[model samples]
Target chain A: MKPVYRFDGFIFASLIAGLILTIMPLPDAINAWRPAWPAMLVLYWTLHKPERFGLLGAWLVGIAMDTLTGTLLGQHALALMVIAFINLKLHLRIRVFPKGQQALAILMLVLVYEFLLFWVDGVAGFATSGIARWLPVLSSAALWLPVAALLKGAMVLARRA
Target chain B: MAGLKPTDVLPGRGPALGTRLFLLLACSILLMVLDSREDYLQYIHSKLNIVVYPIQAAVDLPFALADWASTSLASRRQLLAENRDLRRQQLRSDASVQKMIAIEAENARLRALMDTAALMTDRTMVTEIMAIDLNPYRRLLTINKGSSAGAYRGQALVDAFGIVGQISDLGPLSSQVLLISDPEHAVPVEINRNGLRTIAVGTGDAQILNLPFLPNNADIRLGDLLVTSGLGGVFPAGYPVAEVNQIEVNPSQPFAHVEAAPAAELDKVRELLLIWPGDVQDQ
Candidate 1:
């Protein structure tokens, strides 16, 4: 007899880990450079398994992130749902591209995510903290290759079991 | 790939992406508007926070363990030295407190004779900061004390040096504080030098506070101490707020460019005193 690895369980674990990483504290100098973990996870899952993780899942995760980060409710929800939507539309074309090209797409997606956030903050009259807010986009882009590879490896192992 | 079914290899499609996107976007927009316009969602947010608290605790576990290790494994000599230093600092603080007590008594008597209101006997609860806001645009902190500890919105948070911030959101087991250094926050303060009243606004920089709308000829100068004016009733009177570090006055300009260093260690302080004002008296 062999054990079966559930896709739902695998996705759940990765999302939870993503949530933790999204809120983990970092030093002041590099905190802004921390990758957008939940966004990246949403991109990967939406790209790989669009049926399992969609805009709704991204919205829920974003709301939880809002609560965790203590920001205005729905701010991240709006941004992440948009990200998920874009990823869903482009997932087919994106999945076939090489890792480097995929990372470029991820960069554009993350930039769109951050831009939505910045617009909301502006309308709310919140002061922008220099240009450090955009650092996460670059970091998230740099992180996509490894994150996608890890998720791919995990899915393969889970399916084999 | 040989063993897997065609369905297993292909991505399963979900609901119409466009429709789902539109619906979620509308719902999210509604939520963001409600959250910003009213305090109606506070309880819901607080309840949702409970679901996420465990994750936050898990993230903080490593730091907590290291802190515990350091405290538990310190050498006897180091402990003794720390104790000696604390004792000496306490003695010096005691001397200043003794003088404060006499001055407060005199102030009370004078107020009574003049038929003015007396100061409330403020009670304070010590709380440790649990988390800090990473978004540099917003200055906020979550503290361990909450509604369970009698924490309420608008309660003043202070440190040994001076006032730090105010409790903005209260939860069951935790509360969020808006630091005084937040760009959106402003505190009414009086110059200790000439009793000049002004509003000190945060400049988005940790060390600088902007004193806006001051007359170019206002008797403010560099190195003046600013204390809470208690005008808005948000903060009590007489706590140190900031020290004037730079003052630029131009004859052509209607206002002076005044910047001050916040008296409280806003960036570094870990412990805060949650002040609960005891009573309200009519002046």
Candidate 2:
């Protein structure tokens, strides 16, 4: 590991990959279950590397996502900043938790993120369908371990280099 | 030479979380308000979308590759069958067009006799849909045509059957279309049975539209076809818009509740025609 910390390209590359997956088209039934990949990735990085990835980085990623998805600007940014803050504060405790507990924590955080989105959308007079937006929490929970492992592996490789 | 020191590299604490969250939240609220209420941010949105363009292109690559693979792998028999079907359809359409030419002349003469302005027949550009908005609340799709292809805001989109939607926003290489089935969209339509004019608004369902303001005594009936009335000046006149499927008149309610199925296959149409009105040139 380097003596001094720096912005890791691997983090960004993973974020971009997450961004691509976030916009990837899926069939109708599957689309409703689409995980909030970008937000999830931001959470992972912020939790694992809070010194490097924090609220501002998460905000930028969210804005990029807003642009990619053509949602109202700043909508996703707000939700992601909130998620990042929560993760930053709880990263130590979260890092030591069992996988099942970690998944539960993620589920709660993601639900909060999605609820903020739902509330913002409502306040902005945009209509949303019933219950489908919540479906992603299950998907995000299911994929948390695998995604965490992948990001952990990437980070390990990046540090070694 | 040492073990992975994850916690050592990442300090347990960073900036004051509350203050940063508050500031970011405030900034985001400001952005949301400005973005929703004004058109000024559109310049920024368009410019920022350039950054997003590559992600969209990359995401679409797999689907494109799959399409190419399937087409290449198709048997000669399938290709021949498709070609034969298209040829037959083209010939039938050609015969119809020949008849339409004479009918169009007669229509022009009648309009001239009546001193009414000639109907505006638009020049159309074919565009393929690239992506659909996954948000259930909004009905929108991105099409390959954009300002580069002479697509402009308010340009009408149509499938083979009828009006599909209007161009809501455009980027350099692609444009977003707001479908007629979006709750925010309203089309002025005339009933084909009796020429009764009314506004049909989307009910937030792709398959249905609501004729909300029609009076209880309106002569609309089940299965009556509704066509564009040309009142909006967005959609061209005389294209089929919807078919009346249900009518419910409540004595207590001021207006009848009429529902119609949109004529255009809003959910299934993959290709669209971008219409430029003949009278108004693209700026």
Candidate 3:
């Protein structure tokens, strides 16, 4: 039987990796295309293990992201909270979907995440207009499958250990 | 399949999801409002930034390793060639320094005769950039120096070419610099050719700055050099800021559509010099 309350170092490691990836420097042209790793990680964890990773964890991770990226404090926290809340509410339905449908669901979640960020940016007076603002949503969706697979593989390894 | 899973029923024990979400949302809004409107959160941010410094260093490790490997693995012949090129450049600059010293002495004597205050040389320290903000619109850079090294907020920074930016946030180990090319940044500048003063505002593109206040009949022209007038007391006087590259005078518009290219390579700068402008001593 799976240990219901075992400490999961794998989750912590994955979260750290996600934060690192979010702030990793890229070239100007490709920077816009970088995926929103924190949002994806929050969605993934909250979907897979809502009991452990809930709104509080998501909010804390978002705050870390805000600090790392130097955005207005709480900007990412608000977005990630909204995404995690939605994922928690519908995880049962989403979990049963096929891989393609799962990817589509993840796409929608990422879109909502980016939209919240864009809206917050507008309200904070740092609004930037262009296709660049929406580029990460598409990239995050495309990369979701591989990222999920990688995280699942790590989890499996951790469980075996 | 009909048996209810423990995981499904377990999460409902806490405060309802809606209440938790609403509370978190309210907390976020409060933090944002305080951060944007006041300096209350800056102290907390600076302390929390210590936790973030390691992650930034780890992210920078790959690039740092590449730079180290390239330098350490270079052939002797290549090193010799580089050394020779640097020596030649140093010699050229040394000759210019001699001329500059003579001109400076003459200028000081003239200033004394005119009863004007003497110019003081700014003190500067070199710092390497640790990270660049991923958000293209923000244009912030994190440098290795911080309060430990006398870095303070609003301190001016420059590269080898010209004015780069100013320090906006300070941590114990590192600080964030707001680049002059960020859309929100503006500098007071005057034309080197005619002393026609105007404000050079950032356009979100590192290569371009807009002079929105220049009138149609302003004595600004293409290829004109822009230098800091030191009117704002934030930047030192006579620092090269940008060179006017485009000018359009419209008969209908009240202000001419003028643009200039930044003197510093804002997008590619890997190192910057943090400057402390010398105080003008009163007689």
Candidate 4:
């Protein structure tokens, strides 16, 4: 199947939609349930087509997140780029994995991203970054099924076309 | 003839390696510099919000519908009960206000006799809480009132109970009110029962506020009620701010680490009043 149709306009638009979700005003109680939509969407696309979308796209999307969420600048950008780079490196082997294992890989990638964030902020002495910040990784994993299905649907549509 | 063989070049290398990394590093450094020291990002913070606002509104759709459903489903009996309760409470408040007016008159007379400072009545505006600010660590809420509606920066937001925080960020349609419980926010307060003054700062944890610099032997009791001292010219005096919850003293340290709970129901605040004194001669 041609990679051109799946990873171009639709991918960029999807990333923006994910950013919209990231900025959506959820109350404190429910915010923990909000998945890391942008990270998941970007990583999925990067794994699908590393040739068209790569580290730069992920980094830029992350920087947009940083600006939108008003967090430590470049933190998400750096994390996203690393996620993309590693996923791209594993795309060949990862593509053959069972659905469950693939989901596990995504979880590991998200955990790595969270670890980087923890290391960076912990050293900076801004206390109370809190246990809550890392909760999104678990939430993102729980959200993986719908995301994988959506991406698979898009890929199937492109193949039929 | 001038071209080098392909093997000489690194496989992963893209053009202008140093320049790209330099630009990336430089841009982020510039961003950090602007965000922290220069405050240049505030303009971007203000304007880009317009682009993001539509998406935010769309995101709030489910919440709005939920609120609508709950209100619409309220039984007529419940509505009547609520109305009756409100009316009874209003009457009780009116009677108390009448008594307060008489007492205030007596107070003015006594103050005139003694040549003492008189109490000032603050002008206030009612503003609806639109939504909480997206930053989880920062305790800020957006109020429906804005510059067009006569809201401005540095104005304190309060409820019937006591002070919440001041309007720190202003937009055209709404203003961002940072809560007094934010780590960066500090309110000058006095213990009304004993007249002990201290500054209560937000501790970044939503549940606790810190009162720094109270002497280890400061005449503070465990349950002392704290009120705004009116030292900053922002908040009015005699409004409840917090109740002293815990105090820890180290024998080596001169000051005690005093913690108190916030006066307002911050997590549950749906509506608040913007307290602006009408006799703001400075403005």
Q: Which structure is stronger by TM-score: 1 or 3? A: 3
Q: Please, what are the lDDT tens digits per residue for candidate 3 over residues B38-111?
A: 68898978987898888889888998999999999999999999999999999999999999989999999999
* Residue range with the least summed lDDT across 10 consecutive positions in model 3 chain B: B1-10
Model 1, which residues run further than 4 Å from truth? A1-5, A155-161, B1-15, B279-283
> Whole-model lDDT, candidate 1?
0.85
* Candidate 3: regions farther than 4 A off: A5-7, B1-9, B279-283
Better of 1 and 3 by DockQ: 3
DockQ of each: 0.55, 0.56, 0.66, 0.29
Query: For each candidate, C-alpha RMSD in Å?
Result: 4.0, 3.8, 3.8, 5.8
Best by DockQ: 3
> Tens-digit lDDT track for model 1 on B94-157?
9998999899999999999999889866778799877888787888888888888888888898
- Report the CAPRI category for model 1: medium
Clashing pairs in 1: none
The residue ranges of model 4 lying beyond 4 angstroms of the native Cα positions read A1-9, A20-34, A49-60, A72-75, A85-101, A119-125, A128-130, A154-161, B1-25, B103-120, B128-138, B142-150, B174-176, B233-236, B248-253, B277-283
lDDT of 4 at A114: 74
Write down the worst ten-residue block by lDDT for model 4 chain A: A119-128
* Residue B25, candidate 3: C-alpha displacement in angstroms: 1.0
Best by TM-score: 3
Instruction: Please provide TM-scores, in order, for all candidate models, with all chains considered together.
Output: 0.92, 0.91, 0.94, 0.78
Residues B89-123 of candidate 2 have per-residue lDDT tens digits of 99999999999988989998999999999875567
lDDT of 4 by residue, A1-161 (tens): 23343447777777878987776667668886677787898778777765567667877787766655545567677677777777877888887788888888888888887786666455444444666777878888878878889878976786677
TM-score, B chain alone, candidates in order: 0.91, 0.89, 0.92, 0.81
Give one digit per residue, the lDDT tens place, for model 2 in A1-161: 56335446677888889988776767877998998897788889888777777888899998987777667889999999998898988999998999999999999999989998998888988776688889988999899999898877766676676
